[model samples]
Target chain A: MALKGWKELEPGVVILEPGNTIEYKSGTWRTFRPVIDMEKCIHCMICWIYCPDSCIMVKDSKLVGFDYEHCKGCGICAHECPKEAITMIEEAKAKAEEAK
Target chain B: MVEAMVKKPIVKALEGDKAVTEAIRQINPDVMAAYPVTPQTEIVMEFAELVAEGLVDTEYIRVESEHAAMSSCIGAASAGARAMTATCGPGLALMWETLWVTSGLRCPIVMAVVNRSLSAPLNILTDQTDMMGSRDSGWVQIYAENHQEVYDNFIQAVRIAEHPDVMLPIMCGHAGFVLGHTLGRVEVLPDEVVRKFVGEYKPLYSILDIEHPKTIGAYDHWDYFFEHRRQLFEAINNVLRVIPEIAQEYGKISGRYYGLVESYRLDDAEVAILIIGSGAGACREAVDAMRQKGVKAGMLKVRCFRPFPADEIVKALKGKKAVAAMDRCECFGGEGGPLFIEACSAFFNRGLPMKMIDYFYGLGGRDTVPSEFCDIFRELFQIAETDKIKPPLVRYLAVRE
Candidate 1:
């Protein structure tokens, strides 16, 4: 989003739109990204339940993938996975592999 | 407009505290959260009795501390309620942190600050040290000269604070003991007239609105904090224009006019005194006495302090030969008091070379007689005649050498 001038800002900086935090992409603050191993076969949805930012995606009561746009890359989901089905990878390494 | 012209005022003898209480009764705000502090206690106490009697449908919260008092007012105001509170001296000090938060969040809360001396020496008396301390906290500040102004300013404060152009909190201050404890004649408007004048408080945004959920006091990082704070600056500057318009509207209903700076016999005077709050009455008396004695003396009373009324003040003092800015409180290590410094700065900014000086008096509630003001006027004449300003630009008035 483009930065607003002083006159364009609302009085008191009140957020008029609900759930506008999605506009602020906190994923940019992530030093590490969580990679889930769906093949490990536990769709218990523990990562979905433990993701603090609600970044874990789930459909039909089964875990799908991570919504990295809003994820702050806190390792809570990877640590909470009882089946060890998630791993925290450095963001730079993940991007390097993606580039390759 | 026609109805307001025909509306009659109810004349009553009441102390300044009671006068404010009467105005609050008429405003009948939605919420009042206050704690007891000397000089300011009577206002809330009387209003609480009225609340118990069901005179006004207001939720009066007896907060434990002044901090909590202001905090609760902020909460209620942000929730789209017309909220108010009263405090003085140490109580104002206690509410220091919340004062900034109140304006920063743009909650139009009105607070009656009975001016009193700060502690350490520990005195419960009339002085402007308390409100002057919070002058830069982004709240609109209006001072009253007597019981009538105390009553009138309180009513006007409601509209000024809640104005859409200035969604900022305000502090209406009156001298603690001088006005708060003494009886004076005040002509109050009928309850319905006041109610109609202030009208309904329509908040820009309310937390209670479920259909359009809005977040109040959200965190703003570096990317937007500067812009938001700049908006607050613009809002307060808007007050400089909004106050006079509202005051004019209030004048039509009450038959009492108010301005940012009240110029008394200032047009043809060669020497003048600039003061604020209750001292203005005494200064005016001195100005009248000087005129009777064939001396060209005048006075300017600053009713609104926060917006400073720099242009109006400069215009008022433009042709004067000499002027004195009398302060009830000292600025300690600074060259002069807040009012004096601001006045000098205003004159300097305009490149007006009129001789200006500072006078400190009535700090711990010492009486400032009309004769003492005459002494200041006499000194002004001396400066004007000789064109020589002595050293030690700040003089102590009525203080034992």
Candidate 2:
């Protein structure tokens, strides 16, 4: 629901809740997704540092996978991967491959 | 609050820019970010000197551009800090985008704008062009006629902008060279008095409150945009009542009362001219000169341009035979200058009957002498007697053909 008046605004429109952008579902905007090859991965964490969307997920002191729900697939992660362990895959092909 | 004891200000001779700096020193804001531009350069410079001398404690950041200056103020203001900045003419033009950003976000940042003419021929003179350009940027605009008012208004602005009902930024406008460079007497209040009067700023949402973290300037599409704009309108409209109340409170201490409009000898007058800023001083003289000749002439100086005192103006000019609106800038392709259009609208909305004329004077800092004001009153008198305005109701005063 949209705010209808000044009563709805937090004076000066300062958003009262933070880190809720995860609800926006920016992954729906991606035309391509990055796939990581675990064999060649060195876990340099460069992708974690360079992601513009901050959608890279790392758990238990290791790079697991991208948070596809929020990532826009800007390819910065693949480009920044020092070991060339990541590859760009078309979203349509990735979805079909997932079915197999 | 009793009327028995009131503190009067100590008088001192200071230039217009110095007076504003003196005001800022008394307020002692949390953050001040600014880029130096001429006419207003001295204000930032003096403020910096105060910072260096340990006379005031403030986080002063010298930004690279006017845009960044205002951007820094917005950032500081968003964090529940009292923030302010100053600029003029071209510098203000550079800050155009962020001006809307500051106002749209409802940041209560105060700006001291030394009014100057915009350049095509590269003139660095004084006029109302810069301030008029931002008429709709959602900031409350207050014009000061002299050095004292410049100091007084800046102090009052701190309260007005932070008022809960009117949480909008304020622009304290001083005519460049006219008041900015001239030296005059200004009353300086005690530092404690100003601090008490302004009180502490309390933002409705503080970005620094990590316990309830928040974001500002988030994206909003059509559905929410109109409502947010409506908030700005309601906030500024509240200024019509809030400003006078604040001024009256200020009057109790300083003995100087400010109002939305200042009418001089307008009661029972047949013809009058509406003016703004320092030019009103000359028009007042003209009104007195005309009175010597038994020509019922008067003057009305618009002290508050934004949230304009439309109803008061209509009441002041009602039943008057003729009125002339004098402007310092030209609104090309418009019906008349900015003030002219606004004044006419005020009357037309109320369906009041009166003959009105528009005149553009003092462009690029051209001097408008008393003789010119007398001529305008003469033409207004003719309109009053004949009930007919001279053709081309708008004319440029003291301009070469």
Candidate 3:
């Protein structure tokens, strides 16, 4: 019984359903973003499997790109890249570079 | 569900823990997760026997830790089960976090607490320390004065906890060893009567319900935290109204009456001693002794501790010349004890003019006999007669210190 406000929800209302974290937009908490160099990429999909937020996108056994929408930018993907294909850049700098 | 019904009660000589086990057997809850702890082990032990005998269909999970015990109950309770557990002392301390989780979620789980002293010097004796420590965890707390009351409290707890207006979990406590090990005459009601009385488990919200899935224990942030907490207060506030109604129903079945507070010989008394749990037994004798000595002394036993019967207390001790609030647990470095602080504050808030003092007694299973209570009542009588409370208003009774 959810009482008035979040009292019934209790303090720090735990997310109930699975995959609801996608709606949380954790990327907003990010100060840095992982940028991948496709030419240097080995397509080993290690980053795809190791991203804590599951932000690394893969289609048909191939690494496509980072889904920055939900990435908190902890740099696990950059840290996990065996081929040195990924680089961590300031989110604002990446945005400016993209804008350029 | 209605087929397995027995129509008459069987009176039996049983200890406090056995009485709790009998009540659990009658109620036949959906889930019970417990870990063994001293003074509380017999309760889980007997219940486990029932489970082994296949006498009840309860899912008895013998968990590894008290934390897991309460955690499993929380999981089952969230899944719309009538979940329960039992423990005492450090076990209760271990389950502290999950106690908040269960009560904060408004799960109607019932716990049978065999009250024992907390450990520092490693004592395993009867006292109110353990349960008193968890007073703020948002659960309804009831103290039984005897073995029969222990059984009655546990039976009634299911109703109180499940009452829609008051879905807070309940902890029904009795003194460890003192009551937990002592045998007493307990008249248990017919299985059908108890089953019908406790009724079926109704789920307001269930994690297991697929069609109407809902979130429980959701991560509540500061934005709405106050309102959520206020909801708990709203439910507990409803308990004052709900408890009596449930007790009245219980009375209809058992031919007994109960209330939040039991006022004994207080009507015409000039001085009274207020206490909780089994200590009232001695306080009553002290009251009798005071009466023989022409001192108008009485006793008020607070059966329900949480959603504390503040109004009942204020009304019971209002016109008295003096009162002594006795606490079984100590609140070190604080003003008096927990019960004393509450009683003092309650009287002060209600504008009741009475010379009041508090005493710490029966700590770590140390005995507080009728003589100690007589001493307390005598002091209260002195204060009432002279309108002067002794300088050290808060003192330890019978302590070497």
DockQ of each: 0.76, 0.58, 0.34
Regions more than 4 Å wrong, model 2 = A1-6, A35-50, A54-69, A80-100, B1-9
True interface contacts reproduced, per candidate: 0.95, 0.80, 0.42
Question: TM-score for the first chain of model 1?
Answer: 0.89
For residue B290, what is the lDDT in candidate 1?
Answer: 95
What lDDT score is found at residue B295 in candidate 2? 83
Residue A40, model 1: lDDT of: 85
Segments in model 3 whose C-alpha atoms lie over 4 Å from true places = A1-23, A38-50, A57-69, A79-85, A92-100, B1-9
Model 1 stretches astray by more than 4 angstroms: A30-41, A73-75, A78-100, B1-8
lDDT of 2 by residue, B112-228 (tens): 999989989787788999989998999999999899999999999999999999889999999898898999998777788889999999987777888987889988767677778
lDDT of each: 0.91, 0.89, 0.87
Q: After best superposition, candidate 1 residue B277: deviation in angstroms?
A: 0.2
Two-way DockQ contest, 2 vs 3, winner: 2
lDDT of 3 at B332: 85
Q: B273 in model 1: Cα distance from truth in Å?
A: 0.7
Per-prediction TM-score, please? Answer: 0.93, 0.91, 0.91
Kindly report the docking quality category of candidate 1.
medium
Task: Give a tens-digit lDDT track for model 1, residues A1-100.
Answer: 9998988878896999999898888788789999988788488877787788889888898888898899988899999899888899999999899999
